[model samples]
Target: MSKGQPNEVTGRIFDGATLRKILAQVQPYRGRFVATGVLVVLLSGLVWVRPALIRIAVDDAMPTGDADLLLNVFLAVCGMLLFEALLQYRVTYLANWVAQSVSLDLRSKLFQHVAQFQLRYFDKTPVGTLVTRHVSDIDGIANVFSNGILNAIGDLLALLVVIGTMFWVDWKLTLLVLTPIPVLLLATRIFQRVIKKAFVDVRNQVSRMNEFVQEHVTGMHIVQAFGREKQEAKAFAAINASHRDANIRSVWAFSVFFPLVEMLSATSVGVLLWWGMQDVLVERMTLGILLQFILYVFMLYRPIRQLADRFNVLQMGIVNSDRVFKLLAREERIEDTEMARAPEQPIQLRGTIEFENVWFAYTDEEWVLEDVSFRVEPGESVAFVGPTGAGKSTIINLLNRFYVHQKGRILIDGKP
Candidate 1:
């Protein structure tokens, strides 16, 4: 895709190659990444351990009326909580450090690539678009790691561990508790679709808003001088409204989806309670097991709901990643040859220039400087004046190598 090409939000959210390219940026911090991953795994286990300990306390200590056993479980829970908190802190710090570092490296690389692009590239590409790539888009990518990717992994791990424990206690009750999973998953799918489109619009609107603001501010003098302040202001307001509407759409999707998730969660818990109570009456299930399942349900739905939210972050990051990668992949219109180099020592130009039978045009077959030839010896001063739209400025531009003249040789001190 070209630099200014719009990103399509449908179909696949992330291209495999594009994603790989994005992850490759983290290769420099592999050690930190491994450490973060280990911490996440440990934290996930610790999260599940709390409910397991509670189950043991209720089942073993309470049944036996052993206060010492109860106190030991309580102390162990406290100790585990403290340990989990410490590991969680380390994990968050490492993830954020990697994220900020990646953002820094990515922005620097983007700026360097953009700098190498010829002047014409900038002429066609808006400054606001570039700013979005460097600033907002890169932030989105950082979010993928800090909040979306690794954190989502931890969420999934927690969900799996909770499910596993639920089944270990009672598969029948676990299945009963999970009856709402399909509904929640379907809602998540719908939310993903709605949010994808909303986010795409949000990004586009942001770019447009930036472009409009930048253009107006740079040309504010012209706008006010022509008594077009009201017109420009109206235009700006319209764009601003578009930006706001796009963002609101995303928020609205969230507002709706989260409540649905909560409702489903409540329904699942209600069903679990109704079924578990029947089993308790029959002596087929213990109160400790029932309580453990209730805790597990909270553990389960919390991550499920959070998974949906984190998926949003992941999707936004992918969208921005697509744009940033496209910019990086853009083909430069002008590039110096391998042999191109500056002189070893500082030397003053003799000011001798020649344009031999040069043919030039900004567009096809519409010549601005057709079959043009000129020469000026050292110390000579000459002016070629012409009306507007004539090739006067083109001559100066070609002489300075800001543009390359077609169809002939342009020489300085008789060397091309």
Candidate 2:
């Protein structure tokens, strides 16, 4: 098919859906990820084991005056702690390795794809936006690989272990403590919307600010010569103000979001406390179970809090990734046609070219050049002299093939 045929190119402004593909980009390193996740889960599971050992030491060993039980529980707790540390180290090593590797590969692909874009694409797109995507966006994606993706795995592991242990000890109390999660989830979704809007404004404002500063700096001579520093300063101040407002709104969203989530988390703890007291006093549940329950509750809270924080960032990352994916997905307006032939040997020019019966237009309704004809031969001294609308530059542009003519034959050194 020819370059200008139907579906020649497509474009989109956002590409969030492509994050699944991006995440799958790490499939080559799945073994590393699986090892890391398994290690993290084992490490998190060991944390729950400590409380179990503590409950045993207190309720069984100490009460029964069993010296052997006391020694065994103490040793078991130490062993679990050590194993947790070892697993943590191993997981960190694997995660860092995979994250770094995946980020490197992503960066390489972004650079390569950008290099493949048409020169006109870069000409029309802002250098600041391009540089920002090339550097800042890619770096942000790397941060996601390390901080968001890896931490989510760890957080999930910790949550499962804590919740599983809680259910094992007492299912009804676990249910009580978990009652606030739905509320928290709803709040988090609201927070996600706010954060997305705020961050979009923040990023746009920052980009504008960068563009404003770049323009001012690049044109400082013109501004100074025209005595327009005050005007330029006013423009810069406007851009800065918008940037500041967006940033403040982002901070406000996060500030409100995180604390509300914290309060919700605390509410769960409170419910657990109330249920535990009732179980202890009225239901005759033992003190050790309560203590172990409290410990597990705290452990569970850490993971939940972490999970909440990571989810917020992950949401933002996905949004940004979508933007990047959409950009990456765009096809250039013009490309080599299928079955287009490459020149096998360089053509030697005799400084002779011919343009015959040319008709061209920027659009169909307006012809910029009509029936234009020109010839230049070796040692020819013909100079184009005409008024402003005489198609002088258009002649050069058509001769150089910057734009193809609707009806014309341009012969260069012999080949058309």
Where model 1 places Cα greater than 4 Å from the true spot, the runs are: 1-11, 337-340, 343-351, 363-367
lDDT over C-alpha atoms for residue 179 of model 1: 90
Point to the candidate with the largest lDDT.
Answer: 1
- Tens-place lDDT per residue, model 2, 179-236, is 8778877876777677767766776665565556655676679889999989878978
Q: Which parts of model 2 have CA positions greater than 4 angstroms off?
A: 1-16, 64-72, 281-283, 333-341, 345-351, 356-372, 379-409
Q: RMSD in angstroms, candidate 2? A: 5.5
lDDT of each: 0.84, 0.72
Error of 1 at 307 (Å): 1.1
TM-score of each: 0.93, 0.80
Worst 10 residues of 2 by lDDT: 1-10
The most accurate candidate by TM-score is 1
